[model samples]
Target: MKKHNFSAGPSILPQEVFEKSAQAILDFNGSGLSILEISHRSKDFVAVMDEARALVLELMGLTGKGYHAIFLGGGASLEFARVPYNLLKEGGKAAYLDTGTWAAAAIKEAKFFGQTEVIASSKADNYSYIPKGYTIPADADYFHYTSNNTIFGTQMQQFPDTDVPLVCDMSSDIFSRQLDFSKFGIIYAGAQKNMGPAGATLLVIKEELLGKTGRAIPSMLDYKQHIDKESMYNTPPVFAVYTSYLTLQWLKNNGGIAAAEAKNNAKAELLYNEIDRNPLFVGTAKTEDRSKMNVCFLLKDEAHTEQFDKLWKAAGISGLPGHRSVGGYRASIYNAMPIESVQVLVDAMQELEKSIQ
Candidate 1:
């Protein structure tokens, strides 16, 4: 049986990417050496790094536009500190919009570096909807936000227009949709979701945004240093970076972000339509703010949980359970998930609803 992967992070990637990456692990680039054992500084590996960085910029339409793309070892969690470290000026305020768990985590780290004001939050209602009409202070050095709330299944459809620089953590939805890359001064995302495997984080930074904080950053955490080194400040995560490069190549071959967004929207719509029509289910996120990547819902009749769980499991669906903080189901339909897998889940849902009735 084919498992329809819906786990949030470290989620599904294209099968072709997996096959190519696996072959590289055995004999990379026809060099008879495994990618896992290769030198990061070798010409072969360096080409991988160069192409990966270039593809990242190209995919986001940031090439030749003062944006520098690089891969780093620490996941977006480390970026929670690095972002504020590089952007938030000493004693200056940074405005943050708290929408979910990850957004709150980003805010917590920002406070350690400088004053952070939470301009708005949806936590009061269990993060059911994205907050709107919030005031971003003019005096803020920058405005930071998470584009999509993976845990809550709510995504910000519109961004704030402000004089201050805009920063984003697109960990769950990067490359899964069309975005105006010019709007953000910095964008960071873990490669585990919508990109590739775990172990690397992708950062695209605006050159002018650095050195404004005036705080002396340690060499390791300095974005400028990484950019200067061409993302090879130290030995990088070789395997993860290579796999991500292959995944980006796949994205380009499959028609880039516009194609991915169209497919993602179609998959989300298929599952969400079932969630709304199935008498036994109820969507957790607000209809208008629903995420195109993570579709969260629940059994309206908790008594039918066991039957529905078994039905989906028997149908080869996986990772439909919601986070512990939010008791429900969350189907993370990312760029690589096929419409056929979505149809399977939707069919299982309809079957369960009919069986229960």
Candidate 2:
């Protein structure tokens, strides 16, 4: 039976992407060698890296003028340190918009490299909304924002335009939307959520923005270093890159970023509408700031929480449990999930309502 999976990360991918990738794993491009066996320097692997980078550029509407698309290791956690290290010079500061756990973590990492000014934070309301009306320091190296808060289910509906380079952690919603790439200087995201599986990060940086801090950053941490080496100085994550390639190709063939954004909005609408209509449920995030990718809601009667979960699990719906820190369910509708899968969850909610508590 095809089960509905709503886990936040390492979430659902297009079935076609998985099947094609599985075939390639057995015999990559008819080389008579499993994809796992190929060396990173091989011509076949180089093509995969190039295509993955190209697809990212194409989908994000980057015309290769200023942006350098790169696939790097160490995920967004590593970028937390690297972002400030590469940008913040001696006596310079970077502004961070603290929304939730990941944004708070980014601030913690940025502090190690240089001063990080917390210009705006949503902590007053337990991170239920995105902060607003804070002054960005004019002398700061860059302004950092987390585009989507996966844990808290809030998102920045609109970004503030500034002269300083705009840095963003788009981990949960990179290819799922459309935006003007020129407005962003650096954008990084861990691939597990929307791009593909984990083990790698995709960074789109403005080429001109590098070498400004004037510090000898370690080779790996430096964006310029990866750009110069073509993301192949060391053996890259072969399978992850290939899977990302498949996912990007799938995105391109299936109406690109614009279509994905529409589908994502629809999914969020379907779930949120049900949450509002049902008196027994309450949404966690505010309406204007709720994330299209992660929809968090709670049952009004806490007594029925366990019963609500048990019913869904028995019906082949899994991973609807909310994060421990936040009680309730989080339905993470990423790029690969179809509207039909969302309908199943909505239908399950209706069925649960029809049945006795």
Candidate 3:
């Protein structure tokens, strides 16, 4: 049976990315060597790294705008610490908005460096909605927030208008939609969700934001060091960087972020409409805050769990279960997920309602 994938991370990628990545693994660029064996400093891999960084800035519309893009190891979790380490000065404050797991994790790390203030949060409501009307301390070094909450199925539809440097973790939603990329001082994302695979993380930083923290940042955690070395500060994740480059090429060929946003919006509407219309189902996140990337919902009656599970699975669906923290189902329709696959899940929902009636 043909499978429809909906896993949240290390998740679905363009079919061409899989094919090309596999080809590179066997005989990278016809160089007679596996991508796994290439030297990070080799000419071929260097080209890959260069193009990937440039493509990231291009796709984000940040090129020639004093922004630098770098692919790093240690995933985005590492960035939770590195961000504050390089940006928050000793005894200076940092501001954050806690909307989900990752945002809270970032706040924890920032606190270690200096005073970390959570100016707004939806944690009291189980992170089902985005907090509003919060004040960002103007004297703080930066303000950080997560763009999408994969586990809780919530997304921020708009960003705060603050003169404070805007730092965002766009892990699950990066490149899936269009945005004013210049508005952010820093944007970081784990590659597993929408960019590529799990081994690499992408960080785009405004050059001027660095060298202002007034603390001795470890070379590994310093963004300026990586930028100075052109993202080759140390050995990089070669395979992940190449695959991410391929994915970025794919995005550009398909009309860039504008086109991807349209498809993503369509997929979310199809699933959310069914969840709201189906008498046997209900959505988990607030209707206004529902994520376009991850659609989380549940059966109106717990008695129907087994039946719904069987229906989706039997129809060749996989990764339909929600995160343990938010039980029920989550259909992650990322940039690469076709509308046709969404229809399949919607059909399963309709089938459940029919049987229950």
Candidate 4:
């Protein structure tokens, strides 16, 4: 039986990527050494690093003139602090959109490093809708936001135009859809969810955005330092980067971002329509702000949670449980998740609803 995975991060990776990557580990391109055993400083591994970084730029539609793509450690949590440390300067205020857990955490980290303000939020509707129509301060250093709220299931469908730099934490929805990269000064996403594996994070930053901060930064904490070193100042996660390389290759060969976007749209629509059409299930996020990646829903009778959990498990499905904060179910359909898996969940819901009725 093929078990379907709906767990959010450290989530699904393409079967093809895994197959090629496993072979590479044994003997990479006739090098006769395990990918993990090779030195990251070697020329063989350097090509992998180079291609992985390059593919990110190509995937995002960058022309290769304005931005630098980097793979770094520490997940997106490090970026929460690193973003403000690099972009937020003295006497320079930054604007943030507070949507849910990740956004709130990013805001808190930024406050300790510099002057920060919350320009918009969805706390009023209990975070079901995206906040709108707020003016970004002209003096702001940069405006920061999370593209998709994984736990809450709300995505910023369209970004607000701002004059200052726009930075996004795209940890949950990276590569799941096509985005306008020119609109953002900096974009970062942890790779565990849609890209490849854990222990790696991707960052794309415009060249002009760095070096404005007057404060001194530690060698490792500085974005410019990593960029200057070409993400090689220290040894990188070799195995993770190799797997990501295979995944990017798979993406390129199987139709790049456009193909992924269409498939993601179809999968999300199938489940969201099911949620809306069913009387027993209720969607947490509002209509306009629903996420194309994470589809969260709950049963009408919260008391039947135990029985519902058993039914899904017996069906050989897993990871449909929601974050404790959301208190229901979240089916994270990332890049590698087959639409068939979604159809299975949809069928399960129909069966569960009928049985309950």
CA lDDT scores, all candidates in order: 0.92, 0.88, 0.93, 0.89
TM-score of each: 0.99, 0.98, 0.99, 0.97
Name the regions of candidate 2 deviating beyond 4 angstroms.
none
Better of 1 and 2 by TM-score: 1
> Over the stretch 1-357, how does candidate 4's per-residue lDDT look in tens digits?
788899888898999888888898899878999998999988999999999999989988996668999989998999999999998887788999999888999999999987899999887777887888888898999999999999989998888787899999999998878878889999998888988889888899998989888889898999999999998979887888888888888888889989999999999999999999988899999989999999988999887788778777877787889899878999999989999999888888888788878
Q: Can you tell me which runs of candidate 3 are displaced by over 4 Å?
A: none
State the lDDT of candidate 3 residue by residue for 1-357, as single tens digits. 979999998899999999999999999888999999988898999999999999999998899999999989999999999999988987799999999999999999888888999999999888999998899999989999999999999999998888999999999999988899999999999999898999999999999999988788888988989999988999999999999999999999999999999999999999999988999999999988999999998888999999989999999999989999889989999999999999999999999889888
- Ranked by lDDT, the better of candidates 2 and 4 is 4
Ten-residue stretch with the least lDDT total in model 4: 307-316
Report the number of clashing residue pairs per model: 0, 0, 0, 0
Model 3 residue 194 distance off true place after TM-score fit, in angstroms: 0.5
Kindly list the per-residue Cα lDDT of model 1 for residues 1-357, writing each as its tens digit.
999998998899999999999999999999999999999999999999999999999999999999999999889999999988998887799999999999999999989997999999999999999999999999999898999998999998888888888999999999988888898999999999988899999999999989989799999999999999999999999999999999999999999999999999899888888888877889999998999999889888788888888998999999989999888899999999999999989988889867866
Worst 10 residues of 1 by lDDT: 348-357
Model 3 residue 138 CA deviation (Å) reads 1.1
Clashing pairs in 2: none
